[model samples]
Target: MASDYYITADNVFEYSRGNSLFDGLNEDQIKTLFSISREITLGKGSYLMHEGDPAREIFLIIEGELEISRYNAKHNQNHVIATLKAGDTVGEVALLDRGSRSASACAVSFCRLRSVSFDDLQDIADKDKSIYSIFYHMSRNIGERLRHSNDVALQAMEKQLDEFKTRVTLGNFFVYIVIMLSLFTFSLDGLKYIMTAGKNSSYITLPLTLAFFVFFIFFIKTSNFPLSTFGLTLANWKKAVREGIVFTIPFAAVIVAVKWVLISSVPHYMGRPLIEGLTAMNADPKTWWMFLVIYILVIAPLQELLSRGGLQGPLEEFLSSKYKVPLAILVSNLLFSTLHLFMSLEIGLLVFIPGVYFGWLYSRTHNLLGVWIAHALVGTVGLSIVGF
Candidate 1:
C-alpha cells in the first residue's frame, strides 16, 4: 500500500538529510532549514506551473515525477525538455528574478512536493541575516545541477557520435572518390564542369553546386548514416570555433610562408584573378566581388561539405577503427590535395598544407562549422595576398 501520510519537519529533515539541498548540513541544520517549508500533494497531469504564470514559489520534489515542457512555435506543440523527480528543485530562478515562468510543468505522477514560497523565504530573511547563507546554499545546489546536466549532455553527444561513426561504410568513401574523379576527368578542369558549357558563366555554378549537394544526400543514403553525422550543432558550435582557431594557427603560418615564397615567382600558383574567369566569366572588374561572394557563400560550403563532411568523415570512421586517426587524416589530406593536381605542384602544395590541417581538425572534432570557418579564413587570406 502507498504511504500518503502528511510530512513533518522531522520526516522532511530525515528524507532530505543527504539530499543536495541539505548536503554538508548536520541533522540539526537540516531540520532547521526544512522546518520553514510545508508539503502539498499534486494530482497526476495537473499543472504545477504554466508558462507565463507569475513566479511566487519554488518546489522541491518529495515524491513522483514532473514533466517540464516548453511550447515550440515552429511545431505548434509542446516539447518536453526534461523531467524532474524526487530531490529535484524548480522555480528557484523565478524567486531571484521575480519573472514569469519560461516553461510549463505538470505532474507526471501523483507528486508530493515541499513548497517554499517567496513570502516564506522573505520572512526568514527578514528575521536573520544568516538567511543569506540559505540563498548561497540554494545557488550552490542549482550550480551543481547545471554542471551535472552539462556532463550528461556531453556524454549523450559522445554516444550519438559513436553511433554515427558505426554507421559509416567503406562504400560511401569509394563512391565519392570514383564519382569525383569521373567529374574531374570529364571536365579537364573543375571550372568547366561548373560552367554551363556556353558563352557566359552567369552563376551556372549554382546548378552544378546543387548536383554536388545531391551527391551528399546519396552519400548519406549509401553510408546508412543520419544527416546529423555532419556539421556543428548549437550545443557544440562554441567548442568548434575555439578548436578551429587553435588548430588553424600553426597551419596558417606555414601557408603564409610557403605562398610568400612562390607567389611572385609562379604566376599560376598565385592571384585571385586565377578563379575570376571561371567565377565571373571574365565579367567587369567591378562584378568580381559579386562572383567572389557566390564562391565564398555557396562554393566554399559545398566543397567542404563534399570533401570534409562526405569523404573525410566516413573515411575517418572506417580507417580510424583499424589504422586509427593519423592514417585517416593523412589520406583525407592526400585526396583533398590531389584534386588540385590539375593546376601545378606549387599550387597543389599550397592547398595541401591547409587540407592536411582541415582534415586533421575535422578528424578530431567532426564539426563542420569549424571546418567552414577555417576554410573561409584560409581562402580569404589567400585571395587577399594574391590580389584581384
Candidate 2:
C-alpha cells in the first residue's frame, strides 16, 4: 500500500541522507533513483521477504526498523541475525547474483520502505555511468554483513554452550518456585498481618514494598547480575510505554465489554459496584487519595518487581527450552495467580490474565517503568473503577 502513500523525492532523500548507499549522488541522479524505486508500507510483524524466496529487488529503509532473521533447523527457531533501520539496504546480494534470499526481513514496527530492482539500476546506468557507484557500495555492504554474520554465529555458539552448562535442574526449579511462593505469602499476608495486627491493610504495602526493594538490591549485588537483568533501568522507557499502551488498549476494551455483559446479565452481579465504591470513597476525599496513591506507588511496582523481576527474569536466563521466554512468563504467572488465591478464586484467576500481559510486556520492553505504568492503569481501571 506504500504505492498509494504520497512521498516526494525530497522526502526520501532527506530521510536517507545519512545512509552510505546514497553517498555521492547528485540531485538529478537522486531524483532518478527515487523515480525508479517503488515505495512500500509494512505493518508491524509483517514479512517483507522470506529466506529462500527468489529475490527480484533490493529494499531501502525510509523509516522504522526491520528484523533480519534466518531459520535454524537445529533449534527449530528463527534466529534474528540483524536489525536494519533508516538509510539501510537489504537484498543487495540478490542483485549481485540473482540468488535466493539468505534471510527473512520482517517489520518490527509500522514501516515505510523503498525498493529497486536490478533492471531499474540498468536503466539508470544506461543514461548515466554514475549509477555503478551504487553497485560498488552494495559490494562493500555485502562484505560488511558477511563479517558481521561470522561474529553473530560465533556469539550464538557461545550462548548455546553457556546455556547448556547453566541450565537449571528440575529440583532447582522446584526449590525456586517454593521460595518465591513463600516470599510472596510472607510479604503480603504474614508480615502485613503482624505489622498491622489484621486491622489496617491500606498502609501496609508501602513498608513491605520498601523492604523488598532493599532486599532486591542486596540480592542483585550478591548474585552478580546487572540491574537490566531485572528490567530495573529506564532504557527504552518511551518505546516501552508506547508499545505497552498499544498492546493494552484493545485488551482493556475487551475486559470492559465483558464486565458490562456480566453486570447486565447476572443477578446481584458482583457486590460493591465500582460506582458505589467510588461514591463512598468520594464522600471521604482522604480515602480516595489514599487508594490511588497506594495502588499506583506501592502495589503496582511491588507486584511487577516480584512477579517479573524476581521470578520471570531468573527463569528466562536458566531455562533451556526452545520456547524458554514464553515458558518463563507462563510459569511465573502461574505462581503470580497462586499467590492471589488467598484473596478469592475469582480474584486469583483474574490476576493471571493481567499477569500474563505484564510478563509479555516486560519481555518485550525489558523495562519496569513501562510495565508498572501499564499495571497501574489496568489495575486502577479494572479493580477500582470497573470493580472487576
Q: How many residue pairs clash in each candidate at the backbone level?
A: 0, 0
C-alpha lDDT of residue 295 in model 1: 61
- lDDT per residue (tens digit) for residues 240-311 in model 2: 889778777877777777777887777766554634446533436677668888888888988798778877
Q: Score candidate 2 by TM-score against the native.
A: 0.51
Model 1: CA > 4 A from native: 1-168, 189-210, 246-254, 263-285, 320-323
lDDT of 1 by residue, 1-388 (tens): 1256656766756777656565655666556557777777888888999999999888888788999888988979986767888888888878777899988989998888888888887886686656666677788876876786678668878988866756555556577678966876676555644433553333544555567678777767776655545552454677778887777776666656655666567776555343233343445656666766776687767767776777676666566366666676677668766766654465567667777777777766677788887876676555433332
In order, candidate lDDTs are 0.69, 0.77
The 10-residue segment with the lowest total lDDT in model 2:
165-174
Each candidate's TM vs. the true structure?
0.46, 0.51
As a whole number from 0 to 100, the lDDT of residue 348 in candidate 2 is: 79
